[model samples]
Target: MEYAQLGRTGLKVSRLCLGTMNFGPQTTEEDSHAIMDRAHELGLNFFDTADVYGWQKGEGITENIIGRWFAKGGGRRERTVIATKLYGDMGDWPNDGRLSALNIRRAADASLRRLQTDHIDVYQAHHIDRNTPFEEFWEAMEVLRQQGKILYVGSSNFAGWHIAKAQETARRRNFLGLVSEQSPYNLLVRAPELEVIPACEDYGIGLIPWSPLFGGLLGGVLRKLDRVRSAASDLVTELERNREKIERYEAFCDELGEQPSHVALAWLLHRPAVTAPIIGPRTVEQLDGTIRALEVKLDDKALARLDEIFPGHRPAPEDYAW
Candidate 1:
């Protein structure tokens, strides 16, 4: 369990952030607690979740599950660096979602109660709110910080320009701005390498890549034909589109004597400014299996081969024009 500073902050987080999205939806409470316990035993201290993860509006089922785990004591809340998101509808009311100051305040309080914690290590906006100004966003976050409800602020699914805008606003107001960003970055989805990564780098923001394996497509999908055949239609269609590259990827993983999933995770770990890759596992075994990724070091030759298999974006102007 390698640790890295969260963005420019002194706070350290595990390189592998335990994603709790599967809790209460794909996994039961008992299983979720066991997985979290296993994560801690394995030296994992960073956990990421969202208020809307449980898929039960207003109920916050996943947070409730985690709360129970934390309630069991044993320094669970003290040791773990927990991050949760807002900007999703938690109720039917007009103030139930988005990044308005009201919703931000309400959402933070709601999450704290469900999490059974006094403060959130990192509070992120799940997506860009086109309607809300960054002014309102930072003001609300400042209040949270002053009140000791949240330690740091972050963003997710934000465009490069949006991050720039938010950062500049924070700078003017003398706020700390964003410390981390969660983006869809993987072997198949390298769009973030073009601008988002660069923007985060410029602003001292740590990149926490979600779906590091591209929704499991980069996890040796071709080797699991049986599972692919029974997978969701959309995922199957996506797999078919990238079947050739996936075949090559699995063959490369075989040559290296590593699981495709670990290889994919290792690839992200090798990239610049990536603080951690969120891994959501439904079982304790799966959580334990991911520890191998931290040890699977990719040399220059392997990285070059992966680049040839999945061509990625260069920095902006070079990628587009001259």
Candidate 2:
């Protein structure tokens, strides 16, 4: 339940963000609500979701489930910092998706209705729109801020240069720009260390890492071979590809006497740019167990060993050149 400023913003958020993408897909509505309740009990206040999460075009089933939980009251909506994204196709129409001003306005209103809330703490673009200029993006976001529909703006899956361009445009417009960037970062995926982390650090953007456990590979996958047998074929292939590294990683965690999942989460928490790592747990039990991550401290030696196992990049041209 440690709180940190979201980038340069004065707003504070929990170190672990609850991800609601599983709400209507993998988890039943009742189970999702229970997980959210457990998250709040564990002092996790930030929640991330997307309009396309339900996988049903134009049907925000997950948001509706959260809205129902908020409706039951007990200060649920008041205590949470909700972060949701757009940019996925919500319909067959051309204007139903992307970062165009029209879509931003329409999408914001729709999300507000679905979440049963007046304002979103963070409204994000799920992906960078190659066609839409940053000017258009900021202008749309500014309008949302002026109308009190969204308090902060964010980006996901953006390259380092893309973040630079976004901040430059926001600076010209005298807007807040991106307070956060959500990327696929974990112990195994160290590519962001080369550029994306540097950009976010330079621009005062909080890093919210998704898939910090590498889809459970970093979560002691070898011990759960039975479960992997039932998982998707692609997951099986991925495990085979990374089996050696995962074995080493799990061995390291065993030496520390900690669950592999907690160690992975702890690794992200130890990162300088990370504000929080999104944990998408399907059950209340899983959500409750995540609190242990806060306590597993990794010192210099442990961190050095992890880096040896998964070599990360030094910043930019320095990593490539002398």
Candidate 3:
């Protein structure tokens, strides 16, 4: 696995962050533990989860799975850079969600317990909290930092302006602002390349993109066209919309003798601003398969061809302006 600095911070993290969203829902605890073990064996050391994950069954189910894994008494907790999010509705109470300073404090303690960890490597706000002032949020985050409950703070699903605002607020207060931003970025969803990418670049924030495969649309869907037809309505619709391009993309990957998934991941790694692409593999085999991407180098010609097939993004104002 390749390692990169987490934003401007000196801490190093794996280029691929292991996402545990599927832990308690699509995957069982044993499989989750095995996958995590394989991830560690393969040198991946960053893992991300959220407080509201596995909400269908109960809040923090996924975190509980991770907590159990940590309790197994291996070097699991020590070797990993753990990141978890807050800001989702955890219960019926009005204070159960968002970035209110009270909620932040409560959520931090809860996550720490569920994660079986003393300090979170990166504690993130899952989304922008329109109601909470940056002052309030920072104050809470500062308390966590001073108390050694969290090493760094991050944001997710935030807009360009929101990141700017948060960064400036942190700067003004002499606080170590956002160190990373997790956005949904992939070959199919190049939207982040428009503004969020630039904002993160300017703010020295690492871009850790989730859904890097665009819900398996870029995971060589052509090979499983029959199954693709049965996927969710919106995904099938997107497949139909991009059928021709996807076929060509698959052929290109075939010609290069690479899995389309790896090719897609490799493409993201080539981007200047992306620090890591979160990979949520449900099985050990799937997790092991992704390791090959580290060696699948995309040359200029391949990159240009990918650009022609999927197109590239123009930075911010140029994308919106004439």
| lDDT winner | 1
Question: Superposing all C-alpha atoms, what RMSD in Å does each candidate have to the true structure?
Answer: 0.6, 0.8, 1.1
A best-first ranking of the candidates according to their lDDT comes to 1, 3, 2
lDDT of each residue in 167-283, candidate 1, tens digit only? 999999999999999999999999999899999999999999999988889888887889888988888999889989998999999999999999999999999889999999999
For candidate 2, give the lDDT of residue 33. 89
Q: What is the C-alpha lDDT of each candidate?
A: 0.95, 0.93, 0.93
Error of 1 at 272 (Å): 1.0
- Which ranges of candidate 2 are over 4 A from the true structure? none
Report clash pairs, candidate 2. none
Clashing residue pairs for model 1: none
TM-scores of all predicted structures: 0.99, 0.99, 0.98
Give the per-residue lDDT of model 3 (tens digit) for 1-322: 7899999999999999999999988999999999999999999999999999987523699999999999997799999999999999888888989999999999999999999989999999999999999999999999999999999999999999999999999999999999999999988788888889999999899999999899999998989989988889998998889999899999999999999999999999999789999999999999999888889899999999999999878997898798
**How badly does each model clash, as a count of residue pairs?**
0, 0, 0
Worst 10 residues of 3 by lDDT: 51-60
Error of 2 at 22 (Å): 0.6
Model 3 global lDDT (CA atoms, 0 to 1): 0.93
